[model samples]
Target chain A: MFSWFANPHRFVKLSDWLVPACYVLAAVGILWGLWQGLWIVPKDDYQGGDIMRVMFIHVPAAWLAMASYLGMAVMSFVWFIWRHEVADIAAKAIAPLGATWTALCLATGAIWGKPTWGTWWQWDDARMMSVLFMFFLFLGYMALRAAMDTRQKAARAGAILAMVGALNVPLIKFSVDLFTSLHQDASVITAEGPKMAAVYLWPLLISSFGHTLLFAALVMTFMRAEIWTRRAAQLRARLMTGD
Target chain B: MSGAPILSAFRQALGEAWAGGAGALLPLGFFAGTTVLVPLGVGTEPATLRAIGPGILWVSLALSSLVTLERVFQADTEDGALDLWLQTGAPAAAIAAAKTFAHWLTAGLPLALLSPMLLLMFQARASGALLENMGLYAIGGIAFYFWGGVGAALSATVRRGGLLISLIALPLYVPTAIFGALAMGDGPSSASAPLFLAATTLFALAAAPFAMGAALRLAAD
Candidate 1:
């Protein structure tokens, strides 16, 4: 199914237009989400008034952080079984982007934590620790990929690492949760019976979509850039053969 | 992938690691040294030491396991033994399981044995349920070694891959660390924590070898 991703000409032709379209759509969504979240959303006095706004950014970033890792792992599995360069490339491209979003999630989460929870970080909080482990998982993937001497070896090593990480991440989360869970027990359940007020819910949903779109655009751009870089390297090698 | 005895590789790996004498004891030294440092770094209040005792020891043990992994598969790769094993139709996963179990016997088990003395250093109770603690430590040690073995195999071909191995293995060590630490908590007779710890060990025991095998295949590449 993803064999099309490995076809350089098709990938190039498709991404050439899709890339620009993604960028435009991503910009609009992110801007509206930001504008609505920052200015248009009302302050909820039940929680800390303005600090709650951090949720608009933190929540979406957190969602993307988890999603991107899963995407990387699935791509890695495809490459491991099918030996597709594009799948490998997709996995590689997702690592840094996933890491960046995880960092954002951690930072914004901490920011929200400070005024609301009165601590910048909580060691026992299962969500925070699991996310931090996720950050390290991304770093380990990139480091393992970088240490390899050849493209094939890097892809193979990275694929193995990513898959292992994907499997263990859940166990890590479960273990951490079992020992101690300091985070709120489903904020939606706090007096609201798990039904978020529609006002907050709608914008949060839109903003999350915006973040997802932005992430997709970024990943596509990265994959396209890597494909071009590989092409250039091959062309250079061909030129060298003339010597 | 056969469950039949692959003890020859196990015996071979054990003999090689045991033959290293002083080199083989490096993780033991590293484990004890790191455990002792915790009290020195933080003031030696018995209450404080006892509070942090099991958790710190687990952390040290996890870190020390990295030392055990560097040579597990790398030695075979260097000697061309890895290639031979790949070509011999001997199941890579079974070979990996044998090698890692043997490594646990030599490098990991000693650290598990040493945990009591170190826990004593922290002024924690090493007498009550002493056997239970030892059991938990040993099981957690196996889990650590198996996960560590996967990292070792993945980096078998890379030079100075010790840090990379640690980086990769540490996250995988979370379940064992949590369950092991908690097993020491809520009293010793309580079965839940140990059950969770044992379950984690068994899961790693079952799953990590295939990963190690796949990684060794890549290292062979």
Candidate 2:
């Protein structure tokens, strides 16, 4: 099944159908989650009412944002080692999407922090800076790829960069836990397991699923476009070389 | 295979980088500016001066080392010396190690040598603690430079890859930066912090070379 889908054309065909379906599901799920989170979920025992609601969006977006980058990084390794065209194409397509998710995570994090932490920004804290670092890493990766003129060379260089930069992901995850970090300790997700009650968790999971599915839909669409563009460029090069 | 080819290449091209002289100027200038000029510009109270000294030193290392990063692999690759290195069949890891060593020798060691002078310029008391903090910065700077090497190798071609190098590298430097500053903060005689810095640097030194070498091969291909 994996080999059958390895064909670029076959993958594109599959993505072409699923893309619209993903978008519809993502839209519905997001809407439903927002409605439940905003109006239905009760106020936190400690955080009062409005402040806790942001978690419905913030938590899910943050989770999916990170997951997207890991996905891209794994695909990048596959492209580098196996010379898998589809993997290469998928990674290239996912970069901007991953970057967008990172941005959303930061923005939502700030929105959440302002109400709870009494401040929107803090530098010395590892958690805040770790997220910032991930954002920079994404931008740096994209900028480096763009600067290179050749497709193969760009892809190879980008893959190496993504792999080496993987170290930052752990930094992002554990920054708060390990150091005298400024960000508050993990409220929901923890080694001991989430501290949240079921009412809050159910909506949080739904929103998280929504964001993740949205990423999947976007990545597949972008990869389809990338495959077409690459084929067109190859054809143009071939014709110019009279192949 | 014999190591003779790598040995000869190292002996010849080692000076190619040194010949540029920017490596020496970059770190040395920052060290002077931070340790000397900043103190002169600020108030003269010893307590205030000592408190800020550790931060200034780390900043100097980061800023000054950056100026030399663009020169890391670019000129060699452009002039085909890197291509020659590739042809020599030296292990990629060894080539990366040699370059990283050359960089540390020129950049890191110079900073180490300048530390006493910098401390004196800041009127930092020659307490045992002060000396230990200086040692931490010096050793930590070298180890941290290897991680920087990995970034330098990866982004060597980007138009403003120098800036990107810092972007990619700064996160990795966080633990080093935090630990280094805290080590110094604990006082010059406090051995624990500097020890941590040294230990962290050793970890970086061991791992970064092969990672950078892989990036070099990817860049070459």
Candidate 3:
């Protein structure tokens, strides 16, 4: 099964249908989630009031930010073990999207924090700092990939890096937690499981799924584009050599 | 097989790094220079300097370690010693470990030694805490070298790898920085940070060699 889709031609054909389907599902889910969250859900009494509506987008973006890295790490593993071309392409495709989501998460969190915590940034927030570290990890991965001269070299080096980054992610989170606890303040946010009501929880779940589907769609679209780009380069090289 | 080859590789690496007296002293120089500049940039108020002293020291350590990272594999690879080492049939990870051990000896250890002076200059009062933090710096510096070794190995094939190595390494340095800083902080809770810092170094010891070996092989290819 892996071999069947490992071929770029077959992968492209499959993604042609898969990409559109994912995008459509993502659009519906996201739109519905926004409606439910922004209009139907009651405002929080203790927090930012109507400003908490941003949680609809904020939570999902944050969830996808972490999820995307895990996704890349899994693809990196596949590429490292099997030398799967699609796996490399998929991992490469997911990076910028993941970085963007992470950026969005930070921005939204900042916006939410401004109204709720009276600060645009919180150094003592473990979640915020770790997410920032994750962003830097993404930047490093992208930079390393761009630095390598050959595709295979880039893929292998990037796979190793992704694995290393994956290992460090948890350590970063843990250390940040410990570091923040040493300098404790009365934080508005806690690490406890969501104390949110059903109305808020359901929308968050739906939006999170929507974001996942959206990420899948974007990765597939980018992968298909990358496959074609490689094919074109190969064809051009062949034609030039023949001449 | 005999351990002779690994030992020689280790010695060769150490000798190469120390061959030029200036190269051996570059990180220490950079560490001290950066530490000096911090006060000039951030104002010399003793309380302010003391408050941020540990963080500044760790950042300088991280930056200074990166200054030498490109040379970790670049010089060997360029001169074909790395190729010869690969042909020796020793595990690439073992070779990488030896080389990185040499790097720690030459670059990392000095930084740890120099850190105490900077800490004193920054007006950290507690002698016992300063000594403990110095010990943590030694451990953390070893971890930094190994982590930077992975970056150095990955970018060994690139002609200008200095910036790329920094980009690749500084993020990996985040945990070490956080833990090291926390360990230097006051209170009983801060004591656990050194254990975490040690754990990070141990993890780097086990993980970096393999990652570096794989990346070196890729660069060789």
User: How do all models score by TM-score?
Assistant: 0.95, 0.90, 0.94
lDDT of each: 0.86, 0.74, 0.87
RMSD of each: 2.5, 2.9, 2.9
Score residue A18 of candidate 2 by CA lDDT: 93
How much RMSD separates candidate 3 from the native structure?
2.9
For candidate 2, write residues A1-243 as lDDT tens digits: 435656898898888789999999899888888999999988885763587788877778777667777887888888887778888788888888888878887887788778777778766566667767777778877877887778887788788878867754664445333455755577577898877788888888888888878889998988888888889998999999998
**Residues B61-117 of candidate 2: C-alpha lDDT, one tens digit per residue:** 876666566667776566676677877788777787777777777777788677766
Could you arrange the candidates by TM-score from highest to lowest? Answer: 1, 3, 2
Which digits, one per residue and each the tens of the lDDT, describe model 3 over residues A1-243?
667778888888888898999999999889999999889989985667998888889888988899999999989998999988999999999999999999999999888889888889878788888889889889999999998888988899999999999988988888777644322243323487556566778888888888889989999999988988999999999999996
Please give the lDDT score for candidate 3: 0.87
Worst 10-residue stretch by lDDT in candidate 3 chain A? Answer: A181-190
Off by over 4 Å in 1: A179-182, A185-194, B1-8, B187-190
Task: Name the candidate that leads on DockQ.
Answer: 1
Single-chain TM-score of chain A, each candidate: 0.93, 0.89, 0.91
**What DockQ does model 1 achieve?**
0.84
lDDT of 1 by residue, B1-221 (tens): 34333566787788887675686678788999888889999999999998898889888888888887887888889898888777777778888999999888988888888878888888977576666687788999999999999999999999999999998999899888888887887754346888888988999988998999899888887
Q: List-wise, what DockQ does each model earn?
A: 0.84, 0.55, 0.81
